[model samples]
Target chain A: ETSAKVIDGKAVAKQIKDEIKIEVLKMKDAIGVVPGLAVILVGDRKDSATYVRNKKKACEAVGITSYEICLPEDSTEEDVLKHIADYNENPKVHGILIQLPLPRHMDEARILNAVSIDKDVDGFHPLNIGLLAKRDREPFFVSCTPKGCIELLHRYGITIKGKRAVIIGRSNIVGLPVSLLLQREDATITIVHSRTENPEEIVRQADIIVSAAGKANMVRGSWIKPGAVIIDVGINPIDDPESPRGYRLVGDVCYDEACKVASAITPVPGGVGPMTIAMLLSNTLDSAKRALKFE
Target chain B: ETSAKVIDGKAVAKQIKDEIKIEVLKMKDAIGVVPGLAVILVGDRKDSATYVRNKKKACEAVGITSYEICLPEDSTEEDVLKHIADYNENPKVHGILIQLPLPRHMDEARILNAVSIDKDVDGFHPLNIGLLAKRDREPFFVSCTPKGCIELLHRYGITIKGKRAVIIGRSNIVGLPVSLLLQREDATITIVHSRTENPEEIVRQADIIVSAAGKANMVRGSWIKPGAVIIDVGINPIDDPESPRGYRLVGDVCYDEACKVASAITPVPGGVGPMTIAMLLSNTLDSAKRALKFE
Candidate 1:
């Protein structure tokens, strides 16, 4: 058995946030422009509110001008689109992001598509997606979850090229695009989806594992190669009476089993989740500076 | 040793063109509109010219109207963009194609990006590429070579879903996009590129092999599985003193060896080559009819 290494995502996130803050300060001095971010939060879901608060805190910490648009739970798709159009044309709002899992009445795709590509900090624009798919081409805004996974590998000095990368799931948001990104970097990729009969055996052979299957404990310790790096993207809620929320956050991987086999692995709550909003803030600042012709 | 089934791409191509001709006649009689294609040949390269001429004659034989434009070898990028804009705006023109490998001074990306996504029958536009990458979204144009190979499989009544398919290459034009298309049909895909250490072993394990690496006869007969369907997309020219052209075409798979082992394999010149221009014609017709709102 290989000795396990813990991937310190909290420390890594702090380093990234500090770097963005420094750039943000330079942007303010040179271009007379501080990057501005607009976050649209719908309803009063406690977790969504927490995420929104974290984003606002990150923006403030980075010296970014932050605006929060809180809407009532009964908002319509038209309302969301109008706000998107408003942020789209507003001079001050260079980057716009709507907290995902919007109210049921809202058409998520329609609203997301409405955000102009130039200001789409989330990198969900069709143009950016195509750019990501292009061989040897990297988009300005790569989707944050995948970006964070790659960054976790990079920060830990794990080489992805020529490595066996096993991605669990094939959702456009995570599995598919991450595979594209990894392929561009010259990694040998194997995608295991629902139809796969031997996912554990497939995963156990990975030099690098990216789990976004959203299934709790799907990737067990037994499914990992000794000394593999694990980037878990799933944020599942499990019943835990000891927690005040009446549930606890769990990832797709069983952390205890993985910690014994993986060389480095991220914890569910502190790993990719925090990095997502941080990247949004980073991309927002990028869009702001770029929109102002500063970057 | 398994005997490889001959694919007979030449006969297949002839039959397809004949069928398209009959369909064209019926459409002409039923409706006053005839499919129109615009080909822009910017260089004096003999091979490019021959390809342009072949496309034109194919359209003529099928009773589709062909519009030809031959500019000098040193046409300005602006001049090319202007032509593309004109064709894009024209109501009567249904399809427009610019021959690739433009003059050294010209920007290929700029010119390719100029074609409207709606009229981009080649499916080379960023929007179309983006749409193609999405799991559920469909692009208007599928790239020619990949489309042709898939059509061959479809016509042969080959089921792709759940098959173990391996594509050896990762080019944007062929390998990468074709993998996406095949994945949509539910085939388990494994992409092996130049960095792959054991490509031969990998190919030997696949039920379906799409060889587009452009390395002549790279996939040896021993590497193919019995009853595997192979579509060879490479067209490499080797010196041949016996031929007047001084060169002969060869596919990525050694025909002598592949024919001995593979259940089915496409031939070099007559294989994927002819299907490309045919699909372009189909895309052009689609562009024209959609522009005219005929369907």
Candidate 2:
């Protein structure tokens, strides 16, 4: 029986949070200035609301002041823009986040672009992404999920330079940015999207694989190369009547099979999920430090 | 005895220039407005001067007005910015281009960013590049070299979707953007850079190869898969005793061997080189059409 080491993203995230907490306290002591993250949530979608609440709690835990505005479902686009304008000029708000999936009726790009590039902790700005894609330039912030994936690799001391990395999606938030990040780390990057043929062959060639396809158990054991490192970003749910929730969370990789073939792999529930919030906090802290000229 | 089709960039560029000329005439007839391109040249580099002169002649041939500004090597950044601001406000100028390799004293990024995004015909602006990288969003203009490379593939009727494409280089102008363009066309992309291990092994797997590494005759026949298509963007010069210029320009791919191995390929001097200015003219015409709202 082959035993692969499971990457513990939850534990790593905790370690990172602890580090940020110390830094936040140090800044507060030095300048009497607390980092603040202002979140604007337009709709009350259960999932979005839960995400916002968790973010607020995480901010408070790290000594970051959290400001939140929850508008009704029918709120106009102007209502959201006005709040963003106010936060952009507010000295206390170092980072501004508009909880995503804003009302479909509203222009998503327009709203995202409205956020000041300096205060765009989420790193969704086109200017930020452009800089991230370009060589010899740096983005103001990298999106949370992709940054978390790279952080996991760094914490594990995985060498990315000269490694062959294959990313199994083209998502704006995770897959594309993660590919750019891996390339920046000097990894040879290949992106396999839905249109890719012979994906198993391609996956077999990779020394590192990042699966963000969002399909439950799509990567079988046969698709992996021996000793390859796998980072599964998909948090898919499969029906499980026996479970209390009526469904169980799984990843894009077939965990049982992948564990046998791969040298290291991340678990579904405890993997990339927790790192997102931790990265958000870290970006907010960074933005505050930059704003306050704190070392 | 193997024969492969030569992708003649000069012929194709001529075709594109002819097409742009027709469009320019049609738009002028429809709106009584001609396209205008403003070029800002800094310093006395002979190469930059030649490029500006060629671009002005091309613009004139296509029924477009060309504006030129030449500054001394010691021109301050403010002086350059002042000219850019004036062109940004010029109603007749629909496209603005700042010749690269500015004086050592100037901040290149600051000057490039100062150009208004709408008239950034060079498409070097980060915002334009960011939009190009993002799926479902279009840039105001794509950088000329990368766009010329794609235009060649289209004119040749090469299928990019589901192809395994390998790009050798990561320069912001050619390799990176070309990879994005190929990926957008549904080709699975692998970018092999200086740090990539076993680049030949990776390159052999590609059905399409775009080499912009500026290394003369780096790709050989044995490195290519039979029937694969190649686009060579390298313009490296090697010593040649018989040539009066003392050197001859060569592509990254050894044309002698690659022609026999690949089904189709682009040659240096007559390929990719001429297409850059053609694409620039096309972009200028496009900006004018967009500005005039001509159908």
Q: What is the C-alpha lDDT profile of model 1 across B179-202, one tens digit per residue?
A: 888887777777889997677877
Among these predictions, the greatest TM-score belongs to: 2
TM-score of chain A of each: 0.93, 0.99
- Give per-residue CA lDDT, model 2, range A85-188, as digits (tens): 99999999999999989998899889999999999999988889889999978999999999999999899989999999999999888898999999999999
DockQ of each: 0.61, 0.87
Give DockQ: model 2. Answer: 0.87
RMSD of each: 2.3, 1.0
Worst 10 residues of 2 chain A by lDDT: A1-10
lDDT of predicted model 2? 0.94
TM-score per candidate, chains pooled: 0.94, 0.99
Q: Tell me which residue pairs clash in candidate 2.
A: none
Alpha-carbon deviation at B81 in model 2, angstroms: 1.1
